[model samples]
Structures are given as C-alpha cells and as structure tokens.
Target: MRNSIKSVFAAIVLSIGLFPLAHADDALDASKLYKAGQLNEAIKKIDAVLAQRPKDAQMRFLKGIILTEQNKPAEAITIFSKLTDDYPELPEPYNNLAVLYASNGQYLKASAALEMAIRTNPTYGTAHENLGDVYAKLASQSYDKALQLDSANSTAKLKLNLVKNLIGNTTGGTNPKTNTSNPAPIASIPNTAMVATPPAKVIEPKPVTPTVTKSTAAINEKDNVLDVVESWAKAWSNQNVSKYLAFYAKDFQTPNGESRNTWSEDRRSRIEGKGKINVRIDAPNISIDSNVATVKFKQFYTSDRLSSTSRKTLVLSKQDGKWLIKQERSGN
Candidate 1:
C-alpha cells in the first residue's frame, strides 16, 4: 500500500540540503551505501566517521535517516530526539520526529513535534503541510469515537462519514500506520456519557436577539485583531524589518535566552539578508478578554532555500486604540 507517511519521509530527505559532514568523503560513502539499500554497511561507515567527530549534526542526521529506513524506529527516534535537544535551532529533526510519532498513531505528539519544527524554522513548508494532515487524522479519530459510542446515532454516523470523506480527499485515503492487514487500537480514548435530548419546549425570544448582537460585535473585534496580526506577518514576509519591528510594542518581551537588542539585531540581519520570503497564515484561533487577546495559528513561511509551517502564538495588548504584540511564541 502507498503510504503518506513514507511520502513525507521522502520529502524530509530531499529537503535536507545540508553540506557534507566533517569527514566529508566517509559521509558521502555512507550516503551512497544508504541509497543503494545497504543500510547495515551505511550505519557502520557513518558510525566510524562519528567516532572522530561525534558532534557532527549532518552525520548524526544521516545515521538517523538510515536507521529509520532500516525499520529501527525506536533507535531513529532516539537519534532525532537527541538532535532536537542538542540543536534546538534545527527544524529537520523535529519534523522527522513528528513523522515517527504520526506513524505510531500519536497524532497529538506528532502535531507538537511539527509545531516545534516550525517554531525553529517558521519558513518550513513541509512541516506545515504535515501538520494539516495530522490535524485531519485527529479529527478522524474524534469522529470515529463518536460512532463507536452511538452505533445507531445517525448524526454521529453522518459526521463520521463526512470526516472520513474529507480525510480521503485531503490525504488520498492514506491509512494510519496502526492499520495493517489486521489493525490495532490507535488510541485509548474513553467514551463519555451521551446525554439524551429532552422534548422540545418553547423559549423566550428575548435571549436570542441580544446574543446575536453580542456575537456580531465579538466577531468584528476578532476580525480587527486578526487583521493587525496578519499585517505584522506580511511585514515580516516582505522582509521589511522596520515595519516588522514597528508591530511590536515598545516593552515587547524579548525571546527567551536572548537580550532584546541582540534579538533585534539577529532578526534584522536574518530578515534583510534573506532575499525573498513568503508567509501564509492558517486556522487562526483568537481569544479576547477585555484589553488582552491571545492569538494562535499555523504559520507557513518560505524563503529561497527554506520553508516550514509552525504554530505561533501572539499575546497582544490593546493600547491607545491599537493592538500591538507584547509577546510572541512559537511551537508548544
């Protein structure tokens, strides 16, 4: 059976685009063995090279890939997990981790890993695409559970079928790895008590009119806030450093482990030096309470050489009738 998981794995391998490791010729030899399907020899060669340069990220990455292709997922997971811990700035390992997690039917963990991958490199297109697929899988699980609980429930049945159709359309009906000739339980989600609906009764119309007005106002406010956030994203995408910086409040909290000035300089250089960038937002969830709003969404970013999708959160404070980001975070 054709597997989307394997397809995603192939994309990661292609997207690596990294230079050779310190032991360049040896690493190249190992890579050739891997491509020729001699995983054991590749592993041995890569390990020999790693003995001299244990900290080479590229070699470690290759080893991880070879191990994964060799059906040693647990070992591959260990390598990728350690790489993320040691080199938090690299997005590839996190993306690979998500692939493994998803293959194991751990969609939530996969989603989290993809989020981290995007967080490290917001311009990673592959991660973003995989995240959307993961979300669909999650929705499928939820719908399936509803069907399991109420076998005779027409609404639940209809919803489940609809979700399945959606999943099929989006992912070409690719089954999760948990499904084989004989499938295994993908999750241990417990069933909740389904409340029986009482006979319909007449209610006062007073509650309805005011609720609609309030909802409309809330929606408008949310749209306004989303526009501001979208504009900020656009500025960054366009590589307008000054306009991007302007979106942040004067007292905007700096990123963890970096001084504000240093962070600013780094952001400026990264944005300006990269020739072109494209950023797209998806499924923005915005919550507002008084003068504060929390916005979370998937951020799709692309430059000439890099692309990713990551989860981004913006905490905005309404001041002087304008919304400005006070704090921003990516990933989990």
Candidate 2:
C-alpha cells in the first residue's frame, strides 16, 4: 500500500518538481522544504501560494501532497477530491484520492478512484498497475480473514499463500522462512521399557469447533463477490482487454445482441480506442443463490465526447472456484 501511494506521489513530484506556482523565490523555498521533509513548512509555503491563486491547480495539488505527508489523510482527501471535481480530465487527483482511500482501508473507494483515474486517461499505466495492486490487497485481506475464521480451510489457506507469493514476486522480497534449516530436533527420547497397563475404556471423539459464524461467512462471501465486480469495472475502465475478457464466462450473454466474438471485438475497439472513458459503479445490489449471483448497479460512463448513466445488471456464475459473468444487460 505504501508502495502504491509512494509511486503516485513520485509521479506528481516529477511532473511538478520544477513548475513554479508562486513567486520564484517562494516556490523554491517550498520545494526545498518539501525535499527536506519539513512537511508542515511545505504546507505553509503552499498555502501562501494558494492564497495568491485560490484555484491554482498545481498549487492545490502540491498542498494535497504536503498534507498527506503530514499524516492528514482527511485534509488530503478533501484537497484531492476538490481537484478531481475541478479538473475532471486530470488523472493525477483521482490517483491521489485512491492512495488516500487505500490508506484508510477503503478498498472499494480506492478501486473506484483508480478506475476513474484510468477512465480519465486510459493510457495511464500507473493507475492500471495501482488498480491491480488494490485488487491484490483486497484479495489478501479477504483470504487472511478467511484463515482467521477457519484455519483448517484448505482452500482459503491455499489462496492466501498464492496471494502472498504474488505479492512477494511483485515486490521482489525474499521469503524469510526459505532455506533456513530447522534446528535439529532436541535429542530424540530414549526408548523406555514399560509394563503393560490395564486396557482403558474407549473415549469418544470431541465435537468439532465451529470455525466461522454464519454471519461472518455471509459477510465474507458478499465481500468476495463485490471484490470481483469492482475488479471487473476497473479492468474495463483501464482498457485492459485481456483482464476484462477474463472476468466473463465463455457463455456470457452479449448485451448488444451480437455474437460473443463480435461483441468482444466491439468492446475492445471502444475501450482501447476511446480517447478517455470514465466508468463508475454505484449502489450495487447483490443477491446470491448458491452458485448463481445477481448484481444490479447504476453505471455512469463518460468520455471525451459523450456521457451516459444507466442501470446495469450482471448475472454471475461460480465456475471452477471463481465468479464469471454469465450474462449482462442494461436496464432503465
């Protein structure tokens, strides 16, 4: 999470490192303060700049970074959000908002923000990577919770291990537990001769301990489905054709009444060639019935040349231990 946040900050820093928002000297001073790790001083300097140019986008963006560095997440979020509203075409603010949301453990909000970032700039590789990392983080949290609820759940354990392995590979971190020889078992006990004791009565096995409450399991299941849907939306916004297609089953119904192959090609053209696309999913209604799940939501789509709002529903099927979209349609 820190890595994601830092990468976003690095982008902002590099982009505006030499751009002066205030008077030459003051901007220099502020940049110095920021580099010196005097976040409070940097904030003061940037605030002075903002005072002169109230709506200065660069100044506001700088101040937001300073606030975040000062450990003021709420303030930082407000600043970034305002920037996003004021400069809807800029992807940086949305990326910054995602960093703050992830820091606050609001993965859904973070995912949404990153999606918007990619939509605002479909070629923004940073946002795409950050979105992937967010998915990994969400998966990590879910699988970790599953382990906590049921240590004996082999599936959960295996999934968690796989996630950790992915994270480790991405981060290039070594597994500390690897290659460490175990301490030689403290000397094996010597064989001892013992007289046979009288046969004891057979003991009944103890009742199995309940690993998870029904309420907790329900919540986990709901969260897992939500994560998948969020990821699907993110992949679409990012114009990640491969990842987007992977979320659907081979039998997925085409919303445009076209054959699946034609539909896929159409989606690819629209997503990959659109100048900028912003997709937002809101107020999702999810219902589960065994292996089948239904999700309804408001989808807000925008691009450089057009915008629309529509109700959308997705029918998902649990196949091979994963949720895949089996059908989708637009609604009133």
Candidate 3:
C-alpha cells in the first residue's frame, strides 16, 4: 500500500514536470483573476508570457480564456482565432472560439468552429456536447448527436425532449444511443478547461508579401523649409520644367515680397538661356490639421555661371476632397 502511494506521487510529479505545470498554474491564476473581475491585471500576466515566447499557442489560448471569462469574448475570439491559425491541428481553440461566437450571437460562426473542432478531434467530448448545443438551437435539427455522443446523457436527453415537444417530432421515444455508432467514452464533460493554446506552427512556402508603404504625416505644414533653387538640376535632368514649377503655386510671391513672383516664366527663360541648372529640395516638414496642410522644405539650386537657392513653404487646402496648393512662399 505504501509503495503504491509513493508510486502515485512519483507519477504525479513526473506529469507535472513533463507538461509545463508552472505555466499552467499561471494560466489558471490569470483565469481566476479574470473571474474575480481583475481583467487588466490578468491581461498583464498573460502578456508577460506572450512577451517571453510570442509563438506559444497555449499561452495565447490561456489569454483568450482569461479574456472570455472577463466578458470580453470578442477579444477572446480574436485570440483563439490566432491560436487556430497557428496550430490548425489543435482542436481546443476551435471549440473554445465556437463558444465565444455563440456568446456573441454568431451562431453560424459557432457551428463552423464546432465543425472544425470535431474534425480535428472527434474524440473531444466537450466539442461534441457543444456541437449538440449548437444544433439544438438551429431550429429543427435532429438531436441525433446528443444521443449519439452520450446515449445516456441526461442533459442531452432532457434538452432533446424539450426540443421535440416544441417541434412535434415524436418518434415513439426511440433510444438512438443503442444504434451501432462508434462508442465514445461515456464520460461527458463540457469544455471548461482553461486553454493555453498550442504554439504557432511555421507554415511552409510562405508567399512573399510586399512591404506596406506609409504616407509621412506633417504636423503643421512648414517645419522643414525646402531648397527650391537646387531642384532645378534634377528638374532639368528629368526635363520637367512644368513639374518643378507646379510644386510652387503659379502666383507665388518673390523673396523681395513682390506678388506673382518666383519661378515666373520670365525667371525660367532667364535661367535656361544663361546656363545649366541643378536643384534639390530636402528636409521637408509638413503638418495637416482639419482641412488645411502646411509644408516647408529647403531648396538648393546650382548653376555653371551662377547659383541661387531659397527656402519655401507651401500651404495646401483639401477643398472638395482634393488637396490643392493654396499659398506658396520662398520664406519670410
């Protein structure tokens, strides 16, 4: 008798050592915290695990479980969805997420989740029970599953009776459990297990995804003044005289504070007739507020015979859903 007791203790210890019992305790603590309404702290604890091992599916699952208990099943659903995505072979997240969907009134998604769970683990009793629950709510489906999963499941049989009474589908009280379907373990347990979802698996032959480009935002239009005089070089190289000129409003006032000045057709002819010109604009600072935008950039222009440069700021207005250059200046 003493030997048997020691042997049992040894086996229990071995199991704990083999299967990450410490992390599992953390998961359960997080669940308890969520149940006690300490959701933010629960999230922090779970996030700590994720930070340590981002790919840990089981940890992710536990986080979902905690969130679900906290009445944030939508967040739980997202976490479980990631778990299933990372480990398609795992049946747990699918079943858990189905419950999440059910709680959120997404019955169709619930049914799909159950189906995937059953497909991955037909022997999972909790999934089978939940699937029966899903089918029961679908308006006039056979209760074959509740009877099929556990021929003697009192809850299934009781629910089936209520459903039959509502639908008038009396079948002489036949016991479908006696039929020769595969025998599952008679133990009927609902899935109340705290999930530490399995780790994410590496998918093979991943398609290359293009980098997403982001538009740079400017705070208040003119942080970096542009050097427009230098832009003439590459502007000339690209043969885009009009392109460079368009950057400035046609009626831009000159540095000498004259209206309808700078980059005037008269100035263009004077520069082109004299020498080659190169220009570059750099250090642009821009900002957008409400419907207005401002931009400031440095302009540098060099020529064989003479070189000139100036800083510029352009104000833009989003009028009628279009950004149009409204005001241009070579600087104060």
Candidate 4:
C-alpha cells in the first residue's frame, strides 16, 4: 500500500507546474529549503511570505505541498480544498487534494477530487491516472464487502485475492501499513523561466531564398482547426444554438449513446437555459493526423449562477473543406 501511495504521489508531482509569482525571490528561497529536506524551514519561509501576501496563490500552493511532506495530511487537505474554491481555474490544488484523500483511505473523495482536476484540465494526465487507481481501490472494497456477505462464495474469494495481488504488485509487494512515516518528495514547481541569461549577440543580416517546408501544410491545418474551435466556442457563448450545433459533423458521436435528436434537445435546454454565458479557451494543444484533428484546452465557462473551468477535447474532421466536431469529451 505504501508503494502504491508513493507511486500516486509521484504522478501528482510530475503533472503540476508552478505558476510564476511576483515575489520570486522569496518563493525560490522556500523552494530551495524544501528541496534540501528542511521541511520545517521551508514551511516557516512560506508562512512568512504568505503573511505578507495572504492572497498569494503560488505561496499557498507551496505551503500545501510542504504540509503534505510533513505528513500533516489534514492540514494539507484544508489548504488544497480552499485553493480549489478560490481558484477554480487551476487544477493542481484539486490534484493535491486527491492525493491527500487517497492517503487517508478516502478513495471516494479522492476520486471526486481527481475528477474535478481532470475537469479543470482534461489533459492533466496525472489526475486521470490517479482516478484509475481510486476506482481499483473502490472495486477492492466492493469485493471485500461481498465476501463478508457471503463467506462461502468462491468467486468473491477469488476476486478478493486477485485484487489484493494487483494492489500488492502496484506497491512492489510492500505491505501498505508498514511505510507510513516517510512520504514521497513532491516535484518542485519550476518558475516559468528557470534561469535567465544575457541576450544573444546580434549578427549581420544575410539574404537567403525562402523555402517551403513539409510542415507548412500541417501548420496551416492546425490553424484552421483552431479557428473552427474558437468559432464554436464563440457560438456557444453567444447562445447561437443553431450555429453551435452546425459545428458538429453529421456523424458526430452522441454522448452516452443518446440519439442525435435527443442529444441536440439536451444541448438546447442547457444552453438556452442559461441567462447569459461566457466561454474562453486557454493554452490549446492541437494535433492533426490526415483529415482528423484533436484539440485539448482549458475551458473557462461562466453564467449568471455558475462558473467553472474544465478541460475539453474535441475531435474535428475535415468535411467539405470545413472542420466539424466528430466527437467531444470532457477529459483526455
């Protein structure tokens, strides 16, 4: 169990990147302390910084990581949970919350938090991976319960043993209860630019013939796909249900196996129900293969009574010189 927990923690650490803060020097000092294994000093430094800038998100996030390292899971959970509420657009807080929840055997809560993380950033690979582990844990619990209800059930016994072995393999055969003291190191959140250097020396200009590259076509395709995605978001935001629906291909996959007409009606209700809506996309990553393009990005959605940030993926296919959404999903 300990090994399994550590692996999950490692995934969380790798997926999160620190946002650049105005107080770079102070934050860097605290980060240095943390990496040097002086968690107490790291906490003190972070706390002092937080006192000066109580609303500093970067410092608050660092403090949460430090708390986790100190094995103060409860305190860490509080910090992360508050961050999620205050900065719903960011996914790291929710990811950390899931880690803390899992450590305490709260798999359901962990799964929910991870889902939120993925919602905020569907391309957040770590959250998706953690959710899978949480589901496995949930399955193991269900099997255990089934055996308790029917001790003579051989199938339940077999499943329970299989789950135990699977979990044991995940933890490298270590007992889950044995290594509760030492926690895994959280990955350092690097600043936007880790190091700064002097500008490169300028060189005299030279004329050269421009040449077309093979990637030019691919680049153009990506740009076209991006434009389509942006226009789709704009249509949805403006409540142009007709235009929005037109962005989908005729063969678009209906979510949850709903009929096309049923899906269209459901979408109409949700979109027209909102008094006003605003949707924005950020940091979109686009990939194209032949006539199909896959785009993933952070989607910020706000209406009269609700505001949320989620990661969304859209699979677009070039049809009649137009990019149309063939499929869409919430997370990667």
Ranking by lDDT: 4, 2, 1, 3
Better of 3 and 4 by TM-score: 4
RMSD to true structure for each model, in Å:
14.5, 18.9, 24.7, 13.8
User: Which is better, 3 or 4, measured by lDDT?
Assistant: 4
- Per-residue lDDT of model 2, residues 262-325, tens digit only: 9988888888977656677888889898889899999988877888999999899999989999
28-81 in candidate 1: lDDT tens per residue? 576567656677887888788779878666668777766765668799899999
Q: lDDT of each structure? A: 0.69, 0.69, 0.54, 0.71
Q: All candidates' TM-scores?
A: 0.51, 0.48, 0.37, 0.53
> Residue 310 in model 4: shift from native, Å?
16
Ranking by TM-score: 4, 1, 2, 3
Error of 1 at 237 (Å): 22
Tens digit of per-residue lDDT, candidate 3, span 1-332 = 00000000001112113245565566556555544556589789779877986865655765675566566767877888986665554667787777667555565787888877665555766667656655655533346565787788787677777866543334321111111122111122133333222224545897897554443233222222222323333455334557555555444445556554443665567545554444446566767677667767786656556666688776766655545556767764
Clashing pairs in 1: 123-301, 123-307, 123-308, 124-307, 124-308, 124-309, 125-307, 125-308
Model 3 stretches with alpha carbons more than 4 Å out? 1-37, 140-190, 193-332
**Candidate 4 Cα deviation (angstroms), residue 55:** 2.8
On TM-score, the stronger of 1 and 4 is 4
Which candidate should be chosen as best, given lDDT against the real structure?
4
Q: Candidate 1 clash total? A: 8
For TM-score, candidate 2 versus 4, the one ahead is 4
